[model samples]
Target: MQFQPIYYDGELLLPKIELHMASCQAIGIVTDVKRKQLLMDQLVDHSNYYLFQAQQAEYMRLTVEELITFLNKITERNERVTSLMDYFALKEERKVKIKDLSPSKRMYVTLMRVFFAHQPTLVLEEPYFYLEEQDRRQLKRILEDLSKEKQILILTSNLEDAMISCDVIYRLNEFGFYPLDIRDSEEDKQEVLEQDQANITIQKISTKRNEKVILFNPPEIDYIESIEGSILVHVGGENYDCALTLTELEHRLLNFGFFRCHRSYIVNLQKVREIITWTKNSYSLRLNTDQDAVVPLSRSKLQELKALLNI
Candidate 1:
């Protein structure tokens, strides 16, 4: 059925609105505050019955608070009386409420619509554009969770982001939108294997101080801390005190995951718990032990560190 036109800023309705209007028997248009009132005024004076009928289906444009209230009302109605449940079960679900949904919640709602409503065609526009990395990962998981339930059209400009999550990608180029690439997610397993191989070159430098002291495996070394011109190697369980300068340690462990982050300290590439800015010219490294190491990060080193960490 035709859904209410939900407009953001009144500039345009999402492209899916037109498709829904063509397929559904009824239509509802939801627009923002001033635009909704303007549309309501136009509909009141218009004699076009078809337009008015469509406008009548326009459920009130709900604010975030109002949407919460409406959801509460639905739950209350469902719990209150058996007749209300029966009626709701018999009728086509007519309610459409849009609010500022968290990334996880939005994915959950999309999956619910795909499964319960049997919506054959679904369109999402940069749904995770504003989400943080962790939240984006959760949303990606939800998309994978619902992959078999419906046909989805996702519009995004980030090819790498899309490739990580989507099976079939249609890229928009100067020529026009086309299926630029189709990837079997199954093949992604092989890509991960290649990534593991890429990391295989990180050599393991044995720490020697009167005896052979091997730090934990490459991944277990969170980062190295340099203090008083000496580099301290941080591993999974303990810190290895080394007698090498930050530069010397960087030279020796460069093939491994050691990077020079500051003048006082060169850090183990893997042991970096967090990077903290003490000031514009200075920064400190927070280790896995929760101790803060003040280190001077040059502009060049900051950029290099970002690239190394993929941040």
Candidate 2:
């Protein structure tokens, strides 16, 4: 018997890509804004796929709870409506209108609401920008779950953002879309090597206390914080003033499990005990130490920290 493929209008757009999506594939298209919009337009205008643009998509102006209730009606109770809502940590915002929610929250609701409503092949544009780390993680989970029966076409210019939940990545060139040889990329190889190396030596950070110099192992420190004009290095339960700049330390400890979670702090990912979400938007990292130090988390770098920590 001859095999049939999913229709992309009368003719296929990017035969190479269409052929690969014989089954649901989490595909990433790396391109600039103009090219991304062009692809989205083509998909919406010509294809049978559902396009989920965060800003432009139409989601019924329902409260979060109401949306879940509505999703249950469309795709049946089998749809993962409540779990998805919880995954995005939207339980507290159940009373607010979907339209009135924050940009990031609204984006999550729109994407999931559309999915449950149709479970259509998704063509998402710049889906990763402005997403907090937890939101991105939940989105990754959603995409992975949906990929079992739905094709996901993610369009973005940033490589790291594209790498989130994409199984196959294509680079858009002047000629056309081409496969990104990630395995052959030197930068990727270096990153893999760094992550693989188990033993990293962190001899010390030079410090001046009582007008005397001291050396301490970087791993022994819980975190580094910038206070006033001096850098404070937090050891087990005590703090010491360090001479080297935060930037310098970050560069040196990149191979280790250290991450600059915020502008004023660089944390040891190994010591991060838990991520506390104080508000819908605010987050902090609690460390596993005697003093139980807490470090500020940058909303922007949350995803980066997750990637580094493999959480």
Winning model by TM-score:
2
lDDT of 1 by residue, 92-197 (tens): 2224343344544434333222222234444444445455555455555555544555444444444433443555544333222234322211211222111222
**lDDT of every predicted structure (CA atoms):** 0.43, 0.68
TM-score of candidate 2 relative to the true fold: 0.50
For candidate 2, what is the total of clashing residue pairs? 0
Worst 10 residues of 1 by lDDT: 49-58
What digit string (tens of lDDT, one per residue) describes model 2 on residues 1-311?
Answer: 01122234564333233425745568888777766665665564424577777476536477987877676776676646567567657788878987788877777766665456354577787776767777777777777777888777788887556666676777764535566532212121223223333486566678777788878777887888775456888888677888877777777776677887877678988898998764444467888888746676767777877786677
Candidate 2 lDDT trough over 10 residues, lowest sum: 183-192
Backbone clashes in model 2, listed as residue pairs: none
Model 2 off-target regions past 4 Å? 1-19, 22-24, 45-47, 57-61, 74-89, 117-120, 183-311
The true-versus-predicted C-alpha distance at residue 287 of model 2, in Å, is 24
